[model samples]
Target: MYEEDAQLASQDWSLHPLGELPGVDSVTYGIVTPGPHQPAGVPLLQAGDIVGGVVDQSTPRMIDAAVHRRHQRTSLIAGDLVVVLVGRIGDAAVVGVEQHGWNAARSVGVVRFTEAGQQHGISMWLKWWLKMPEARSRYLESSAGSAHSTLTISTLTQLPVPLPPLGFRTRLLRTMRLVERRMVLNTRIAACAMKLADAHFVRCVEENKEAPRPAAVIADVGEVVGGMRRSAAIEDGLPVAWAAPAEVLRHRLAHLDRTDQTTWAPPHAVCAPGTILVAPRPGGVETVVSRIPLVPGRGMLALRVERETDRMWLLHELRSRSKELVSTAQGQQGREMSRKAFSRFTVAWPDSAQVREPFARIAVPLHERANTALEENRVLEALITTEFTEMAEQTKGKR
Candidate 1:
């Protein structure tokens, strides 16, 4: 049985340098002018084209026609393989069909299988080669400059591809394609959840815009507490939960919100449970609230809600209007949030403290649901990564 298998494999095997092979063509990298100097033309390949290892031609851009005549030979056809050379780096995709109007983006290459019979084999080969560890290392090694790193054609031409039997390559591609299809489905599902979260935020903001302001408020964040600082640990330390601004924004874990805070050493301020951990600096387009998560640290910054006040509702209020808090702190090096700035910030309170009760009813369940959905996405991402790693290893063995 072993001898028979060896002969069968031998019959199916072939080897050649990528350049020596006929029909395989490198991609055209060129510049296009927006004016009549180049009329709107061909479908261009972009770095973003390689999402989950497939070409997304859905958002193809048109270049000036004059530019197409300049780089006429680099035309894309159905069998060509497109590989990214910069930015996102090394993502590969197959050209679906000949697109006359489209031009290729910078630092991208195409491999066209000359022989029709060999097209599938070559596409699979290029895709698998791009994913290999050697290819990625070479890509990183070849990147130029201290500024924005880039990979050139010379780097790709020198990449060593393991030559395996056509039968083995085909089998490997088949298995991976199946896994990819499932992963794509999961990705779309996660995207839907994100869309819902965005919509919820929009609705809350609109509703608040229409509501009236409260009469008198006790204190804003700055008056209640000061900044927390922590140090890095070499090995181990007490179970002090350390949080960055990101965690706070993500969980929206108002006063009583809980999360597994990573531990750190001294110098880092201890965030006691109930303290509103805010991001010192806000980002992009109107400094909306920092995307910081308020953690129920081990008793730090706990809220002292009055008899009729709902702490959970207050957390949601802070979260929904985080952008405003961020905007108020704009200035002073665009860095840390000044405690003084936070202290003077105005919060609109409802006419009656009884408003907090109804607010909690809406806030608590939504908060829990958001946390559950986020956890699910994390788990799914991990599962996909593990499956891809194991499959790559198995395929490497076949080679």
Candidate 2:
């Protein structure tokens, strides 16, 4: 892709179409019809399942094994590179050995290249390449002019790829893997911290029910602020983030990725840092926490609280019992949340003097721990791009 440089004028690198590369097999999308969801069935990975640059197995939907068997042609094999095709285009993650038998939805592309190319590790390099900004730009360019942006299989097959010398490619990816491993370790730590906090929240709720206490409505702790309809004009603002729906539903992490931020339209009403938002996803509305300054944009409703300490409790109330939360709102707001519907929802609150404050002491630190890990991962993500791009520019001479 850097062939435009004057120094590379005499370089003999090949820029072959991805499908034409020696190591690539068929590069294609996943199952078109997944049938109905089955509670006990084979997991079907969707674009939504590729969160924070990995295939999060826990977040995928389940389809009958029969449906999965019918879509065997697109079955995910261990080491295959899964690429998001519909939304958040160009997100890619290698299928780990644990995900070998899963099937993917039509919105995800399944690419398998067992380390083949002009070099020994082209598949690994290409997997990381697809996650790079430069490659994302190409994917966006290819999807131009559609009613909705989407990466067609034809464009991906024809996408150009470099054939760097083995030594440079190996050394570059070797360093990259070390950095990536640390990111993943941090991700696991954050996940564990969240799980522990959730467990504590559950225990406290159970213990509170043992004693007869006055009932409480959601309004006791927080206010349900409605969403603002955002437009393209928002891009002119100083601090902006990904569209609300994309930020909330695209991933299953406790913290949102800061690298995805962009300048958007100025806000008439900005939600506080610890506001808890309930937004509509594929099935129903779910809770998401935003640590950064945020505006409650379309398809999102924020639970603005007086104290930041109350956030952890309120977040779990909406998140852990979200099905119950959505059910309460369904009679009034349907699947979407409304102030009227949210007003009627009730949650068991512990006495502030005892349970609530102590839980906060434990939960707040865990939330901070997760935020710290995700923030560091963002820095490492930037470091990866810088190191890889710099190495790529000097690769020709190295070879």
Candidate 3:
């Protein structure tokens, strides 16, 4: 047992290895050798599916029912805590009510708590505890492997957990549950806002279906500028916002009001507010392009729209036709689109300013609202992090 675990165990609270917990019915890994993926079958949950302490059922891989049956021990149901046992070790998410009848990937571990566990809020407590920095560090220290680290069953079984008094646990659970509920509500609100914007954009486009489509090659509408190759040593550049391909992938501006100047490099391409950013490389699932204008940092491309063009309209149109845009990308490794190719890509251009005005008027506000909700979620996340840190400190001081 770790010294910290011993210290906590010596206190009034009981400390037990995870496997010995009476409420925990089972702690097991998923399918060892999954069969080839299928277009439609049983939903197979992987480590990546868990994001923001919840299972993201969107875009899950599937396997045959036979394979799922073969891995019955690892079959997931609601109330189970799924932990990433490989790569991003210690990341966990609870199998939600809607996520029943799912099976886990080899990279994930399923912790199924008993009815007593549910009554005691074991899953809820475990989810928050596993996310603590100290817990994560301990897990990392026990994990083995070079290129791809993994958590062994033995290591997982030996993991220690603090079992405080039931009353204290209940109060803590209630507080955290309220905060989590708010966060979940905020996320849903943000999603609905974005969906509303998309719907409005579609309606606007459909309304102008009868109008003549004045098409323009992307090159004609804007200047396709490539990002600079950042220097290895950044001892000489001015401090500025730097946007990377990852930020573009996430459809968000990178380093907002950030102070890190080391990543900021020159050619210092300042992408204006209306400019569209494109990820020439293929890796992310969320459209390979975005229009969240920011200073183009490293490994990204920016499209500076012509002054007369409708930037919002263009953004919506690109997003609507993202599949075609992704298909246009060339190259074998990493599959990237060049500036020349981007320049030649053609899109429907609104014939009149009047036709595009409605979209901008309605869509902009909806997007703004969504962005506001996202920012609120970020603030909430920061607060939760602080709370968790303080809680850990207090628990440590109890010794």
Candidate 4:
């Protein structure tokens, strides 16, 4: 345990096992070993559903009502706090009114708070508390299972929770709420910026849909090359930005701060600005093209466009048609679109400079603005994290 947390533990604040919280109606894991998902039925919330201290219902898997009923113990309701007990461990989010009918997956532990007026404040505090770095470390330490770390219901039940005085709790909740609201607002702004950029890109493509198409293959416009495959034992190398498929999927660039040096790639392997880094075999092939340039690592491919093409337009076009390419990929275990396959793929290239230039002028700025918004959100997130750490330290000092 952290020294600060230990100090807090000795304070006058009451301590209770998580399961002993006053309003907790039920504490249980979700459906155990659920079967294959269906198209339409009860929405199943997984760990991925919990993002930024709220349940995102934007994308959810479906299971039949019978399956949902079988897991009635984990049936979610508004104000219920869902904690991830496996994989991600202690990440948590509150089930909002919109997510009331959802049922969680086995990896998600549901805590339903029955107390009316006070439930919201307590639940919010718990959500933030669990997200703290020290709390997450404690959860991992207590976790069992060698193959994959897991928090069993019994173990979770015994987890310690500090209960400060009602007045202190209210004040702390207010401060946390203010920070949370700003964070959420920043996220929403970033999302809106990206959406606007996407809309503009789609509009540009649609407007030029009827223009005379020039015959060209992907190879004609760019150099498609595979990424470096480093040996597992090789570690010593100059630090360089290395990006995997996951980073590309997030539409973010990899940097020295975020990427570790497993091994360095050759100079040719380094991606230049305006390079299109594509993950042909991402878990979700529908969203494969990265909006940002990045150093592609193994299992990824880099495309450096040599021809005069609008980079943003090319990116959007490839994304728009990614599903088609994914369908043509030939791997049986994990589908991968090889360099050969990508190179041969044909695209309707707009040859007119007049048509392409205007599109680039408008689309580029929108995407740049979107990227700026995303960068701002990242800074805000870091600031909030630092603020939380400082607040925790202050609390310990006061005690």
In order of lDDT, best first, we have 2, 3, 4, 1
Give all TM-scores, in the order shown.
0.54, 0.83, 0.75, 0.75
Name the candidate that leads on lDDT: 2
Best by TM-score: 2
Q: Flag clash pairs in model 2.
A: 234-264, 234-265, 235-265, 237-264
- Cα displacement (angstroms), candidate 2, residue 352, comes to 3.2
Q: How does model 1 score by TM-score?
A: 0.54
Report the backbone clash tally of model 1: 32
- For candidate 4, write residues 1-399 as lDDT tens digits: 243333233335565677875455568888877677788788999876665567766668898888888877788888888997765567788888888888989889988765542443768767776766766667777763344467777777777666665566666677777767776776666667556666776786678678766757878777887766543333443434666554454332211123322446545556666667676553444333333334667666777765334565566667677666674355664445477877888866775475566767776666566556556656765665565566566566443
lDDT of 1 by residue, 1-399 (tens): 344234324534333345543234453444433333232465666665655566665656666566666866566666667777665467677666544335576756766565532444557666756766656777777773434346666666666555455465567667656655665665555445434544454555466666775643326423344434444464544555555443333332232233323445442344343344555333511111112233222212223343323445444455556566655344564445545555566665663434555555554455546545545545654554454456456556554
lDDT of 1 at 228: 49
Query: What's model 4's lDDT at 232?
Result: 34
Model 2, 146-236: lDDT tens digits are: 6556988887888777656445556777877887899999999898988988999888888777686655788776887776654345444
Each model's lDDT: 0.50, 0.72, 0.68, 0.64
Name the runs in model 4 displaced over 4 angstroms: 1-26, 116-120, 139-168, 219-234, 238-284, 288-309, 397-399
Model 3 whole-model lDDT (C-alpha atoms) = 0.68
- Give candidate 3's TM-score: 0.75
Candidate 3 per-residue lDDT, tens place, 133-192, comes to: 767667777763344457767777778877775666677788878878887887787678
